[model samples]
Target: MRRSELVLLASFTLGLLTTRDAFAWCRTTTTQGFVPTSEKPCDDTGIPLYWSTRCVGFSVQRDASRWIDLATTRSVAQKSFDAWKNSSCPADPVSCTGSFDQGHPSIEVKDLGPVSCDCVEYNGKVGNANTIVFRDLAWTECDGTPKSDADTTLALTTVTFNTETGEIYDADMEVNTANNPITTDDPPGRVLYDFQSILTHEAGHFLGLAHTNLPQPTDKTKTPTMYARYEQREVYMRDLSNDDVCAICAAYPPNRSAPCDTTPRRGLALECGGGDPETTTKSGCGCMVLGQKPSGLDAVIVGATCLLGLGVVARRRRR
Candidate 1:
């Protein structure tokens, strides 16, 4: 049965690919329960998260600071994690409907290479480090200076889980040079800000998924990269919708594929100086939970005179 594998099994029974579904998340508070006490994470009713971890490492930050360039930010963050692991299902990633390829995704994203420190630290720790950085010149929001709010967030993803066992451990993503203008180059109108369509909506919050809404009414001009914000030379939030494939098949469904060890239980090291607080509390860790977006606010606002220079979340549109 190989007429090109029966035309790839009739393109998966004629769904004709290019698909996605409704999905939403970004919340906290766990001990083995849903999270969403709502203060932010772009809170619209946050309470659907995943990543019980098997391996995660997205490192990048090798002195290409304040001007952005270090092999085009690690080649568009590995094409935004291969647009969710090549949209799964080579042999049935749970019948792969996509949206981070539904469940038993066995969480894997290791390339954990470069490092000169791009902190997302969780100091109450023993393990951490999952990053992606770019903030040339300057840009800080989440009440840490540099337009400390009032809309202008182009990109920012931060997740630090386990208020009781949602277990994320760490997460970080920031992109937004000073004020605007960010690129991965696909030109046409060139208003910039399409670095792999906001690194695939910050890799859908680096895999805990959230910010979805744009399925029932048809009035969002354009939504779902997890749905929060996108517009301005708008590069179509780089795919995934059907409510983000029904929110990763209702949080990691995909018929439980196993045998994993993606290798990054939590990593970080190129030098931040460690000397054993148990090997710096269990190798390369960091997380603070201050995210920004195209300005979709699910988390931010912490100022008692906090101002860094690089620590971002910008791109505010959807009002």
Candidate 2:
């Protein structure tokens, strides 16, 4: 199937958008079975996916992008994560009336430098890297197969989580510099996609947020950072709106007592294939050789992209 068709199908299968408020901020969900009868805040489909930890580490692909340098790419990435990381949830009382103040989201993003693996992958039994790669060559599948929306997709994010529990294991982002002209310019010139805005939106997906509104939103002021589409030279998504803040805060409420460790789960795997030698030793497990997947895993990969026509890249079933 085409990328767009696959995405539409995934949306329908996963139920595209789920929100508690009418403003349209939604968290990405995966289905295992049915919701429980008791009201422990269960999603109707299955479970809402989220990072179970307070600190998350992300790495930029070592082969950054042909269009932009590695230093700039890394810099833009930190700024993008900061757009959501630094947001003040529940709207400060000073800015708006009748609003209560809540602390920032209970999450901290750390830059784990660059890695050799540009592919969107998650290792169940071995080491893995939460990566942000730029496809300056072509927008193809992880195995190099051509994608139907190669020319249209701006970026994509792949999130791996336990299907049974909705706890995210790893997330990787791929930017379509192959087809899109990404700019670091403040206004992003005509038809040039803003790099910061694109990464910020992808970061939302990396953090387990689905699009705020499916069919285009009419309220410009309420247009969230998680909106599924991007317009030419549009940089508005670089900042989080009220809806975006609410969604993130709801997913990760401020908890000062939460442990803050900025390490990628299972340590860090820098290469595309096989685990990091150090990581493997630390975890006391063998590295994946020749791209072989470990057996008996219950994890599923759910990807949410930045622009329209991007699909959920892969969903690995149990072996």
Which numbered prediction scores highest in lDDT against the true structure? 2
**Clashes, model 2:** 0
Instruction: List model 1 lDDT by residue over 1-319, tens digit each.
Output: 6799999888876654323211133322222222223332334333435576445677776765455577777777777666665444323222334334333344557667777655544322234456676666566532254533323566676565543335565566767666676666675755456777777877766677655533322554345566556665666667654455444544554565544554433335454432112212111112222321121122322110011112223445658
Off by over 4 Å in 2: 1-23, 32-43, 91-100, 188-191, 214-222, 274-319
Candidate 1's TM-score reads: 0.30
* Backbone collisions counted per model: 43, 0
Model 2 lDDT tens row, 162-261: 5556778788888888887788888534436778888888888888877664344586535577766776656777888777777787778775456777
* lDDT score, candidate 2: 0.66
Q: What local lDDT does model 2 show for residue 151? A: 57
- Considering summed lDDT, which 10 consecutive residues are worst modelled in model 1? 300-309
